[model samples]
Target chain A: MNDRKTTQDWMKDWQALQRQYWTAWADATRGASGEAPDPATPWHEGLEQWARLFGDASKQSETAERLLATAKNYVALMQSMLAAATGKAAGDAAAPAWTEALRNGLNLPGLDAALHDNPLARMLRELRGPGAQAIDQLSASFAPFLARAREEGLAWLGAPALGYTREHQEHYQKMAAALLDYQDAVNRYNALVLKASRRSFEIFEDKLAERDEPGRRIETLRALYDLWVDAAEEAYAEVALSAEFRKVYGNVVNAQMRVRSQIQQEVERIGVDLGMPTRSELNSVHQRLHELRRTLRRRDDDALVELRRELERLRTEVEALRRRPAQAKPAAARSAARKAVKTGNARK
Target chain B: MGPIHIDPQRAVAELTTFNQKLAAGLKTLRSLDEVDYGATPREAIYREDKLVLYRFRGETSPTAKTPLLIVYALVNRPYMVDLQHDRSLVRNLLARGEDVYLIDWGYPDLSDRYLTLDDYINGYIRRCVEAVAKRCNVEKINLLGICQGGAFSLCYASIHPQTIRNLITMVTPVDFHTPDNMLSHWTRGMDVDLFVDTLGNVPADLMNWCYLTLKPVRLFQQKYVGLVDILDNKEEVENFLRMEKWIFDSPDQAGEAFRQFIKDFYQANKLVNGGLRIGESEVNLRNITMPVLNIFAEQDHLVPPSASRPLQQHIGTQDYTELAFKGGHIGIYVSGRAQREVPAAIHDWLAAR
Candidate 1:
C-alpha cells in the first residue's frame, strides 16, 4: 500500500511537471522571438528569486526533458491527424466524426470536413469562411425564384425573348406616326395660310399698281431712254479707244507712224550714243571683264578695258565736235566764234 | 620523294567562286537587314502616328488562322529577333511557315514622359492586338512576350483573355521575392523615386551600363579581348559586328511606366498577390486559361531560374509546358547553341498545338 501511494504521488508530480513544460513550450513557440520578458523589480534580485523558485538547475533540466517529450507527442498527434484526414491510414476504418461535427457546428454545409482539416484548407477557411456553403444556400433558396421572376419580369417588361421589346418598336412607330401627322397638318395649314396671305397681298399689290401706274410708265420710258443713251455713250467710248476704231477712223495715221518711227530712231540713236556694244563686242567685253576679274583676283594688272572704252568714246565725240567746227555760230555770234577759234588755236 | 606543286588555275577558280558566293550571301543578308540597328527608327510600334506592323512574307504559304503577335520589351529593339540570317529567331519562325507579327516599340521621347501603365497595357497593346486581329481577319491572336514585355503581356492576357489564342512568355518574372536572384536583391534596396526623378525616363545607356556592370570584369575586358582574336576571319568579323550592333541597340523606358513597374511589380509584389491593376481591370493570373509555353534559360544570371519557375504553378492553364534551355539570357536569341534548341522547341510546340 505504501509502494502504491509512492507510485501515485510520483505519477501526480510527473503529470503536473508535464503540464508546466507544455505551457512554457507553447508560450515560447507562439510568442515573438528575441523579445525580453517584463522587467522584475530590482532586476538581479528578481532573477535570483526566480532562479531559486523555477530556474533551479536540477529542476530546469527535468522540465526541459518533459517539454521535449511533450513536443514529440504533440508532433506525433499532428501527424496522425493529418494521415487520418487524408485517408492514408490502413483499413477502411472511417476517420473520427469530430471533424464533421466541427464543420457542421460551424454551419459549413456541403463542405468535406476531412479535407478542411488539413493546413491548406484550414488557411483557406480562415480566409473565406465556408463561403461555398453560404453561396449554395443562397443559390438553393433563390435560384428557382430568380429564374421564375426573370421570366415573368422579362414578359412584363414587354421585351422579346431574344431581342428588344415591342414597347421600343411601338414608341418609335408612334413617334414616326406623330411626326408624319404633324408634317401633314403643318403642310395643310401652311398651304391654306399661304393662299389667304397671297390673295391679301395680290389685292394690296393691285391697289399699289393703280396708285403709281402713270408715274411708273413715265419712269419706265425715262429709264429706257437713259439706259439707251448710256449704252450708246459707253459703246462710242469703247470704239474710239480701240485700235480697230483708230484704223476705221484713219485720223492721226501719219502722225502716229511718224511718232513710231521717231521713237524707234530715238531708241537706236540712244543705243549708238551710249556706245552700246554689239553681241560679239559684248562677248569680247565679257571676256575682257572675266580677264579683268581674273587679273584682280591675282592682284596683277591695273588697266581696265571698260575705262579705256569710255575714254576713247569721249575723245571721238570731242574730235567729231571739233571737226564739225561748232557748226559756225550765227551771224550775231560769228565775231565771238571767230574769237573763240582764235583763242582755241592759241591755247592748243 | 615527290614535292607537290600548287594547282594555280584551280586555286584561282575556287577563289573566284568563293568570292562570288560570299558576295551573293552578303547581298541576301543585307536585304534581310531591313530593320535599322543601333538607331531607333523615327517610326516605331507605339509612335503617336498610325501604328504600322511589319509583316515578313515567308516562303511558305501563311496559315491564316491566327497570326502570332510578338510583343518585345522597350528596353531593346524588336529586330534582335531578326538580327541576321544564321542567328535570326524571327527568320527561323518564318522559315517554319509561322505568320509572326512583332510590336516594335518605337523609342519613346520626351513627349512620352507622361505615358503610364494604362497607356501601354490598355492603349498601345490593346490597339496593336486589335490591329493584328483586323489585319489577320481573326478573332484572336497568339501572343509571345519577351522579358518585361512578357510581364506586360501576362497582364494584358489576363485582362483580355478572349482575344488571346496561345500565350508564350520567355524569361518573365512573376514572383519577385525569389531567393538567389541578383536582380531582386539589387532592386530591394534601390531608390526608384530618385532614379525616376533624376533621369525622367531611365536612360537606356544607364540601364545598359548597370547591366554590363553586373559582370563588369568579363564584359569590359574579356569580350573585346575575345573579339580581337576572331578579327582575322571575315565571317567571324561580320558576325561579331552584327552582335555588337544588336548589343548596343537600346531604347529608353518611359518614366511613368518604369515607376509603376518598380513600385507595383518589383517592390510591392502585386502581380503574384493578384493586386495588379491594368486600367480598371484586376489582373488575376488564374484568368490565364489559354495554352501557355514558358521558356526560361537555366544559366541565366539576370533572370534566375526561381524568378520564372512560379509561372507554371500560378497560371490556371493545364496545357502548360516549361522548357528549360541551358544558356544565358541573350543566348536564347543569338547563340548558335540555341539556333537548334529554342526555335525548334517553340516551332514543334506551336505546330503540335
Candidate 2:
C-alpha cells in the first residue's frame, strides 16, 4: 500500500513537471512570430517554431539550419532525460534506463529509418560541404541500377555478344560490375560504422558507471549529452584510425570513382546521341591545349635562356673591347694618332 | 547510485534559456552582413595565368632588408593568413616592420587539369620568388611556407638554395609515414591515376568532406551544438561566420598537381626518404643548408607533429631551429595566442639572422 502511494505521488509530480515544461516552452516561443505551441508536441517544436519565425533567407541560413538540426537533436535529448528523471529517483536507475532513453532520444521521430540509430551515418550524410555531392545522394540515384544488377546474375556478363549493340551491352555489363563493387565497398564501410556505433553505447555505459562516484556524477542534461559525445568520438576514433578502416575507406573511394567513371561514360554516350558536346571531347581539347601550353612554355624558357647567354656573351665582348682601347693604344700612340688626324684634316 | 542527477524543474529552466538564446541569436545572425577577409592592404606585383603575387603594404616602411615571401598551399585560399583585422598574420607581421609578400594560387578549373606539380613549384613559385626578389632589389628573399606550402618551399629551397636567405616552415609534414598521420594513411592505398583521370580537378567540397570526416562527431555536430551558447552575441556570431566562410572556401586543386602530391609526398614518403624532383631538378633536403626555422603546431591533426618533427633528422642545416606551437594547424594562424606568438616569433628569429 505504501509503495502504491509513492508511485501515485511520483506520477503526480511527473505530470506537474511536464506542465511546467510546456509552460516554459510556450513562454520561450511566445515573443517569436510563430504559431502557438501544442502541449502534446515534442519540446523541439519550440525550437522549430523559433527557427521558422526568425530564420530568414540570408547568408546565415545554412549555419542557422545546421544549428537548428543539432539543436533539435539536443532538445530531444533533454526531453528524453527529463522523462527518465521523472520516471525514477534522481541519480538512481540511471544506467540502463537512461541509456535506453538516450538511444530513443537520438533515434527521434520523422528521421529516415536507416538513420534512426546511426548518428555516424547521419553525420556522414549531412557533412558534405557546399557544392559537394553527397555520397548517399549519389547512391540513391544509382539505386535502381544497383537493385537490377543484384537481381540479375553476372553469368551473362562475360558472354560474347555479336550484334550492332554488342559494345553497348558490354559497357552496360561493366557499369553493373562497377556498381556491384561499389555496393560491396559501401557495405563494408557501413559494417565498420555499425561496429563503432555499438561500441559507442558500450563506452557510454562504462563512462556513466564511472560517473557514479560522489562529486563526479552528471547533474545536467548538457553534461550527460557531452559525456555521450565524448564516448561517441572516442569509439569512432578507435575504429577510424584502425588499419582495417583505412583499407575500407580506400576501397569505398576507389569503388565510387569507378562507378562515377562508368556513369560519366554512359552520360557521354547519351550526350553524343543528342548531338551535344561530351566530356571526352572536352577532355581531348583540354589535353591538347595543355600540351600546347607546355610546349610554348618550354620554348619560351629555352629562348629566354639563349637570350641570357647572348646577353652575357655581348657583355663580355663589350668589356674586352673597352679594354682593347686601353691596351692596344698607349698614351704616346694616342697623341701621335691625334696629330696625324689633325694633319689629315689640314690636308683636306 | 547512478550517474545522471537531473532535477526536472532545473532541466526545464535550462531548456527555456537555451530556446531564448537560440531565438535571439537567430536575429543577430540574420542582421549580420557577409564577412570579408584579408584585413591588410596589398598590391598585386605580378600575375601569370591565374596566379597573382601580392605585396602587402604596411603602415610604415619595412625595416627588414629581405622580403618574406609566404608560399601558401594551393588546396586553400591564401587569405587565411590575412583573414581579419585582429586575427591577421600578415597584419601582425607587417606591424613588426617585416615586408610580407604572398603567392595567391588562384582556383583551378577543368582547363587547369593538366597542371603538374612541376608547373606549380618550378614554374609558378620560382617565378614568384624571383619577382618578389626583383621588386625588393635583393638577390635572396626569406621564405615562409605554411602547411602544404611548407612542403613546396622545402622542395624549392632544396633545389635552389642560393635564392633563399632564411627558410621558415609552419606545420609542414616531413615524414608522411608517421604512425599518427591519418591523412597519409588513408591516401596510401588510393590509385592516384584513377582518381585524377575521373575527376579533372579535385573539387574543394570533396576535400572538405574528407577533412570533416576525420572527426565527424566533433566537427559536424558538437561544434554546432557548442555554437548555441554564442548565438546571441553578434560579435561571436560574426566570428563564427567568418570562420565558417573560410572553412568552406577552398580552391579546386589542379588534377596533375594533386596526383603527384598524393603519389610522391603522401604515398612514397619522398620528402624524408629522398628522391624528390621538381621539374628537372632533384630535391635533396641536404641541399637546404640555409638557416632553417621549423615551426610546428603540437596539436595539429592535419599535419601531426610526429610527421613534422622528423625535419631536424632529414635536413642538413647546421643552423636548424625548431619552435613547437601550442595549438592546431589553423589555430596556429588565427588563435589569439597565435596572434601574440607566431608573428613575433618569426620576426624575432628572422631579425636575429
Candidate 3:
C-alpha cells in the first residue's frame, strides 16, 4: 500500500516537471521566433524550433547543423532516460530499463524504419564533411542512370550489337553493369555496418553490467551517452579491423572507381564530339610536362656532377702545386696561368 | 542498485542547460569569422612548383647551426606543426634554439596527377632538403618527418644518407603489415592502379572519409556531442574551429604517388620487408646510418605503435632513441602534453647528438 502511494506521488511530480520543461523550451523559443513549443511533442523536437529560428542565414549554419544533428540524438537519449525514470516501478532492475530506453531512443522519430535502432548508420549518413559532399553530388547526378540500370536488369547487357553503333551500345552496357556492381558493393558494406550496430548494443549491456558497482554507476544523461559511445566505438573497431570488412571496404571502393571510370570515358567521348579538350588530351600534356620537368632536373643534376668533378680536379692540381714548392717560381707562374685560364673560361 | 541513478529533476535541468548553451554557442559561433593557424612568423625560402620551403623566424636567433626541415605528409597541410600560439610544435622547437623549416606542399591538381612517390621522395623532398642545407650553409640538415612524410623521409634518408645529420620520425609507420593497421589492411585488397587511373587525383574528401570511418562513432557522433560542452566558451570554440579547419583542409593527393605508395608501402609491405624502390634508386633502410629519433604516439590509431616501433630493427642507426608519446596521433603535435614533451624531447635528443 505504501509502494502504490509513492508510485502515484512520483507520477504526479513527473507530469508537473514535464510541464515545467515544456514551459522553459517554449519560453526559450518565444524570444527567438515566437513559436511556442507544444508540450505533447517529443523534447528533441524543440531543436526544430531553434533550427527554423536560425534558418540558413546563420554564419555557423554548418556547425549548427552538425551540432543539431548530434544534439537531436543526445536529446532523444535524455528524453528516454526521463521517460524510463518516470515509469520505473519499485523492484525493477535499473540497468535493463535504462538500457532498453537507450536502444529504443536511438531510433529517433521520423527516421526510416530500416535505420531504426541503428544510430551508427544515421551518423555515417550525416558525416558528409567538406570533400565528402562531392562524392555524394556525383552519386546524385548518376541516380537516374543507376535507377534505369537497376530496373532493366543485365539481360540486354550481353546481347550482341549488329549496327555501326555497336561500340556505343557496348559502352552503355558496361556503364550500366558497373553501376549495378557498385550498388551491390554498397549493400554488402551496409550489411556489415548494421552488424556492427547490433553488436554495439551487446557491448553496451556488458559495459553497463560493469557499472552496477558502487561509485561506477552512470548518474547523468551525458555519462550514459558517453558510455554508449564507448561501447559503439569498441564494437565498430572490432568490425573495422576484421578481414571481412577489409574485403568489403575494398570492393565498395574499387566498384565505385570502376563506375566512375566508365562515366569518365563516356564524358570523354562526348567532349571529343563537342570539340572541347578531352581529359585524355589534357593528361597527355600533363604527362609530357612532368617528363620535361624530370628531364630538366636530371640535366641540372648532370651539370652539377660535371662541375663537382671539375672542381675536384682543380683542387688536386692546387694540392700538386703546394707539393712542388721547390720550384717556387714555376709553381707560382702555373697558378697565375690557371687563374687567367679560369677567368678566360668565365668570359667564354 | 542499478547502473544509472540520474534524478528526474536533474535530467530536466541538464537538458534545459544544454538547450540554453546550444543557443548561446550557436550565436557565438555565428559571430566568429574564419580561424587562422600557423602561429609563428615564417619566410618562404624556396618555391618549386606548388611546394614552398618555409623557414620559421623565432623571437631570438637560432643557436643551432643546422636547420631542422620538417617533412609533412602530402595528405594534409604542414601548418599542423604551427597550429596556434600555445599549441605549436614549431614554436616550442624554435624557442629551444632549434632552427625550424617546413615544406608546404600546396594543393595538387590534375596536372600533378602524374607525379609519383619517386617524384615526391627524390624530387620535391630532395630539392627542399638541398635548399634548406644550402641556405643554412650546411652539408646536411636534421630531417623531421611526420606520418606519411615519415615514411617518405625513411626512403629519402636511406637513398641519400649523406644529406641527413639526424632523422626524426613522428608517428610514422615503418611496418605497414601490423595487424592493427586498418588503412594498410584495406589498401592491401584494393586495386590501386585502377583507383589512380580512374580518379586522376585522389580526392581529399575521399581520404578524409576513409579516416573518419576508421573511428566513425567517436569521430562523427561523440566528438560533436563533446563539442556541446564547450560551445559557450568562445576561446574553446575558436580553438575547435582552427583544428576543424586543419582536419578537413587536405590536399588532393597526386594519383601516381598515391598508386606507388599504396602498392609499395601498404600492399607489398616493402618498407620493412625489403625490396622497396623509389624511382630508379632502391631504398635500403640499412643505409639510414644517421642518428635516429623515432617518436610515436602510444594511442595512435592511424599508425599503430606496433607499426612504428620497428625502426630500430630496420635502420642502421646504433644511436636509435624512441619516445612513446602519451596521446593520439594529432595530440603529439597539438595537445598541451605534446607542447611540453615533444619539442623538449626532440630538442634534447638533437642536442645530445
Best by DockQ: 2
DockQ of all predictions against the true structure, Cα-based: 0.00, 0.58, 0.51
Best by TM-score: 3
Query: Once model 1 is optimally superposed onto the true structure by TM-score, how far is the C-alpha of residue A133 displaced, in angstroms?
Result: 65
TM-score of 1: 0.44
The candidate maximizing lDDT is: 3
Misplaced by over 4 Å in model 1 are: A1-348, B1-52
User: What tens-digit string does per-residue lDDT give for candidate 1 at B1-353?
Assistant: 00111122232232233223322332233333323332111223333332346666566766646788888877777777777777777767777777877777778764455567877887678878988798778898999999888999999998999999999999888887775554554455555665564345766765665466344324443354334334345566566656666666787787778888988888788888778896668899999999999998897877777888899788889999999988888888889888888777877888777
lDDT of 2 by residue, B1-353 (tens): 78888877788788777877876787777778898788999999999989999999999989999999999998889899998899999999999999999999988888888888888888899999999999999999999999999999999999889999999999999999988888898898788888888887999988988998888888888888889899878877788889889888999999889999999999999998888887788989998999999999998889999998889888889999999999998899999999999999999999999
Segments of candidate 3 deviating more than 4 angstroms: A1-11, A27-30, A89-91, A128-153, A327-348
TM-score of chain B of 3: 0.99
Error of 2 at A263 (Å): 1.4
What is candidate 2's CA lDDT for residue A126?
Answer: 79
Q: Local error of candidate 2 at B171, Å?
A: 1.4
Q: What is candidate 2's lDDT per residue for A213-298, written digit by digit as tens?
A: 89999888889888988988888888888999999989988998888888888899899999999977888898899789879989
